[model samples]
Target: MARSATTIRRSTLTVPVAPLGPENPLPPLLPRDDPHRIDPRQRATLPPDMARQVGYAPLTSVLPTRLRDGYGRDRVPTDLDTIVLENDRLSVTVLPAYGGRVYAMRHKPTGRDLLYTNPVIQPADFALNGAWFSGGIEWNIGATGHTTLSCAPLHAAVLDGPGGAPMLRLWEWERLRDLPFQVDLWLPEGSDFLYAGVRLRNPHDGTVPVYWWSNIAVPETRHGRVLVPADEGWHFGYEHSLTRIPFPEWRGADRSYPLHGDFPADYFYEVPAGSRKWIAAVDRDGDGLVQTSTATLRGRKLFVWGAGPGGRRWQRWLTEDGAPGYAEIQAGLARTQLEHVPLAAGGEVSWVECYGPMDADPTVVHGPDWAAARAHAEKRLAATLPEATVDAAYLAWLPLADRDPDDVLHTGSGWGALEVARGGYALPGTPYDPATLGPDQRPWLTLLDTGRFPEEEAAPERPPGPSLVGGPWRERLECAPGGPLTDYHLGVAQWHAGDRAQARRSWERSLSAAPSPWTARCLALAEAWGGHPQRAIAVSLAAAKRALATQGVDPVALAALARDMIPVLLDAGRADIARRVFDRLPQDVRARGRFRLLDARILLALGDREGARAVFDAGFEVADLREGDEILSTTWALLTDDPLPAAYEFRMRPA
Candidate 1:
């Protein structure tokens, strides 16, 4: 089969494992307290004041069996195990045993702020059956309150449809000790018009409540506006209580001092129990808005915090030394790995909150086509998904970020520092002053634009291909003025350099500036790079379809490209989505025999031995036909089921 002529047909390819949840060691839940650093030098960095303000305790502390009993610390309790909750609004499982806790917890104590905590087991010195375990403490109730407990170690918190079916987000981990198992839970299952969740499982499992507060740093611009519901709330306290601000809400408390900057903050609103209201911090000038909640918890309560842009608390912990923009749904946990709760022995905790979109001007929705916003999000989400084995490929890619020769591109340590390449793709890249791209770079830029360059010049004096961009790559993306190629290159470069924020921005801009099948591929890779495989799969399929209609491209080539991404996508928690996309492809595309070897590798994901054999058979028959490097290598490995062949090749081109 001619590789270029082969069409891609959707086919079912089951991912053996779910996407890997956030598993690496994130920054400590505590605030950054580098006394040696100074403002701008240390400005916007996580402050010591923020660290001291919030309480974070690891579960590693010897929890006398008594407290353990309260939190189901002993054997996984049967009550919390193997139970599934289903209803019209939502479907979920709560498994207390086998390291599976609540998938979605929604029942809030009469007067408690919605708080979700993971009950994890600190394994004994000697491994039990050579196993280490952890689980989630979550609850999901529909609008009517039907619930279930899933004990399958792989299933954790998931967002069913906004108003439809349940989407499973399983929380799982390998048997690695000394790493905190964490899980995130959104207080409200499906609230208002938006969905958000916070992963709060930290490795430490310290005794502290680990109260994390979110300060939505929304930006106001000339053409943008912030949107949030207009509702009443009580000022609980400043996110970082140490930040000096107006103390109108503080009765007799001494307010922290030396307030600076132009934007003055007012209150820390505390939403009371039974209050179903949501708030939004909007930038009328820029059209940016953050709809969030602020609540204070005493004993096992969830504390949700927020601050306006440029406010003390917002700038303190959120602002990084190199990157100043800060707007995220944050929590006070190191990872999403939760401790394994022993059956019904652990204390049961529930969180309740709602999310809604507020109209900044109420007429903005009517001002322009309101559908545009929804369409934008849907399109973006669609562009972020992949097909077939792409998810698995994504799952495999997550760990590689840690092992990446340029770890600064994808690790938390490299959150913001990175650069984009000329293709509008985010990849491991180096920061070069545009002014530096002189005659020497013309050859490279020409190749980047036309996808062709002299073979002789291809081998540059730099560190081989794509590695000589920078030394000690940045931890974030550093933006500069440039065109589509510049932005694209910058995005990929930042990703390669390990700056997620920069990568996200550059790729988003790349797609907007030039929405094409290639841009879709770039978006999918970026999502996979960020550890979101499901989204990656979705976008890949859309891109394939778009390419089919617009570019008259071969589907098998698309599948082959998609298949290249399966490992990383799987790592990002989109196994189901990836499988769905693969299954949806046309059958002719599957039998094209072009990506046949690659498809055979996908069989390993689906547990199809016959499929594996078929690929090998074809490989043997076509031994004389020169095959692409990826196809030849993948086929050889799948046929023999050996690890060695799979390891070799693919060093020259990125998946």
Candidate 2:
């Protein structure tokens, strides 16, 4: 056998470690009258009188607020000096202030940091709710995607396990769903790897959908390649839809290699039915990192932005310009980014993943030869200390005995408690003023009653209504503040009732609260109907951009946004723009049978009646056009110079 390049040895010395740097404080809240104030439309569903009485703040305010000591303080740095773990070959720093994220990790042998470290600790409106920072290993738990708790502080401690092995432990209570999770980062003696063991416990009496994904970022390099042991995997794209494609090969390109100036792509791959549980990324220098976990960590994902202008802009936004942009190598508990694992109430799920450095020839990195590459990588990994040893070290260091159920500081309500729990006093020297909540104020009551309390008063019962549209539904929505969908329905009712102004207002409010493709399309239609066709086109484009920027991972939203824009663009007499929008839509969505009429319309608008007929025929062969039957029939009659029916004129009505 060839001599191993590096040998493992045991050591007994106090590891030299310290806080990596000063904490990066969360930005102070903008003044109430600030131009960027959370939109009133978001609060449109709330009863006006109650909204004023309780002084309800938007959900974004609770995010990025400290859960522990720094609560309510403006500019509280998230990087508190707490604990660091280091060995001869590696060093790891944990930030107790910033959701206990592993701030940075360095492989001593190569003097290279395996993880990307953002130079500034700035928060942006990037998370699902709002406010997130880029870089480091982000621990996400809750419903799928980046969880709400990703940026808040988590309970953290330094533990001594068997043989005095030091491990850094971080945990947080997912108060939104009442789940408790803990992560342990262990760098054992003389080992060149960092081992992580995660445990999620459901304390409720009923099962809940739980999502957990560890997002690891590394610098993007020209020769970078990601290796996952699979021949075929599920490809997730616009609208969260899935298509199985040959591994690492997408659209006739070897996606495992770095992409230069291509459209942005987010793909998740389900491990082949009997593949090993490991993924690795090799850089240009042939030095790389390998991450191996148990079968429970089933999903492997790659999120990339090709070296295109749009991709470069995102890179600059995430990091400073001139710095190499990074890519995410994510590990998830489910099969895809949108899929959530079902955890039984009172059940426990635990798994361990190992990260270590690897050196290999760059030629074997990118693959249609995944089997050969995987075999070589496996052989290299087999020479290291047994995985069981790392698992034992983690189990011994888990701080289960120290966990507190009432330790709810990592939640939205936990941030609220920082003020209300302390005699209802607001943060000192800050602009925030706690509302003098009354028994019937649902917003204030909900905030105060989170965690350990039960509600003191029930919401007033809404009057029974015959229809969700029109006056009765509008009145109910006004009284209780339904979310975006309810407001959207109200807008539709207003439009049909010839109250165009009110409809526009309702749609604007709906978009402000949650910018979804459906809501944007409705807003555009409402604008066009109200005689602002240019504004309608502009808003449609803005909505598509926002959907791509903030909710890029949502393929369904992207597809819907693209599909809805076709009609809006055509309505605005911008057939050229409509063509561009149509071209950008995912082939899967554009090829769907339901979109055939839309395809035909676009062709007709472009003066391609012959092509339109062909596309229409193809679409009809695959899809039953029940509601759309009239549009197609009329278009065909017109094409053949046949007599048109009275209903043909209805096609000219507002779509």
Candidate 3:
């Protein structure tokens, strides 16, 4: 017979005796026969060769150190063991059974360092052995193969320190369309990888159906928020609506959940398809946030979005306010993408995404001279970004991220939480805040409190604007604080692409007349967005100065507002200006919060994973707002390359 040889697993160190003959194997192997013969007195005996080997032979007598330690105790043989390798900057563990597990561990000795994670392989609760392959390469089989790989430049992984400890892990697995997908796991000695993944084979023939998704989890907490980028286009098989992105009716009707209830079924955000994507959620305090994207991957198109509370079939792993939160990338219905490797008899596909942790919001890029950095990145991506994909996809697909602004308020009367009209008041304590509008506007608060807009009563010519009920309502409102409530209308329009110059003018005038910090800040933002950087800076600085001048602006509110402004500032190229503001920030504002959602975004932009992870660790608390369900749409948009913003507008006439 040709010399037979035993296949050795290079990744492991076990030496198994192989190619033994059936007759005289190492020791006479026992079979299910000849245990006790019909003669009761006869007993089975070891074969002569086995007995000789067992009698104090060097191979038989030598035992592992662990066995020596537990010599007298009852124990089973240790089939597998892992050891951790601690170097100056990393800690890696190796497992005997799985080769190398827990591959990389990096510490940001000075600033935040970044690292990438390999895709997880979760097998059944027990089994755990998988191979890993890494590096940048393109295969030539599928229709879109090579062209797709050339679509985008690669983004490196980031590392950050979460509060001086290890918290976040990032991995960038970039892939393009029309390519055979191959992912392999690598195991080094002495490490046991935490999660086990199972590989599945595709059953589809070569028709080339596209599908796959990623599941990513973060620590969850009560104060978490999600942000997504916006876009404009119609690449996905759906239309956009003002309140909801319309999925094909055939896709099935989507349900709604209370903004403060459970996690949604499927979160989707509507952003412009195929455009520069950026979105995030900030902890109320602005300390942390996580930003991510795959738009830079060759041949891969990316959409922006997130999740809301309760709307889909599965319960969210996040506590309405708990630890360990997560965001996922999905393809098809949840069932379609799980371990599904589909291709023709020999076809395959691969996908990749990049995630960055930020200690602050991306909007606040001014302070650090990131212009050069931004320019460098932009130039690199521009060289390879596919013309076919740029700006082609707009709108976000985050359902949970798109809840109606009105849904936020509800002061329950006997009527329960109900929708009031534009400029309406609630029963009170409804998920929405009442203080948001001026008092004059409260009377006009959608009359649902009693009825629809009340008919006008005849009276001597009254000044423009609103009037309340009973006892000289007009005079009381005129005397009572904050200027005319017209700012609300202007604020809403400012949020849209309306005239920010005019809007800022209106909001500023009103704030000056009434003097509310919120109004002042809003007016400032409008000015900034409308090409009035100096004025915008002045406005916010004034508030900060005033607060400093007048007993420090409510530190908490100031911090919250500042955090919110970070992204806006970054987007507008006001990083330098924002730096000034950051320096003057209150001591309390600088203190860490429960979750640093905003911080993650900032860290991501700066490519500091260690810092980003720190913020994410603190910002893990995501509240269980029914609004979470709204995020599913965004999630869908990101995973499926669909572009549509939440609130697809359709001209409507009262039926």
- Model 1 lDDT, residue 349, Cα: 23
- TM-scores of all models? 0.24, 0.54, 0.27
Q: Which stretches of candidate 2 lie over 4 Å from their true place?
A: 1-82, 366-368, 390-655
By TM-score, the candidates rank as 2, 3, 1
Local distance difference test, candidate 1: 0.31
* Candidate 3, superposed: residue stretches over 4 Å from native: 1-502, 511-516, 528-535, 547-549, 552-556, 576-595, 603-610, 613-655
For 408-436, candidate 3 gives per-residue lDDT tens digits of: 11111111111123223321111223333
All candidates: CA RMSD in angstroms? 27.4, 17.5, 32.7
Q: Judged by TM-score relative to the true structure, which candidate is superior, 1 or 3?
A: 3
**Residue 307 displacement in candidate 3 (angstroms):** 15
TM-score winner among the candidates?
A: 2
lDDT (tens digit, per residue) of candidate 2 on 1-655: 3322221122222222221222212111111111112234533443354234223222222222221111111233333453567777787766665566666778987898888776545454344433455677888886544555656666555554335565555665564344567776677666788888788876555776677788887778887887777767654432223456786666877877656326455566757656657777778666777787766787788777666544554565444447777787888876655545668866878788888787776666554487787677766666774545545654664543233332222222232332233334322111112342233233323323441122122111111111123243344444554455556656655654557688778778866776655566667765765689899898877765555555233554455456556777888888777777777666876776546667777778888888877774453421222211245456666455654322232121112
Identify the candidate with maximal lDDT. Answer: 2
Better of 1 and 2 by TM-score: 2
State how far residue 559 of model 2 sits from its true place (Å). Answer: 31
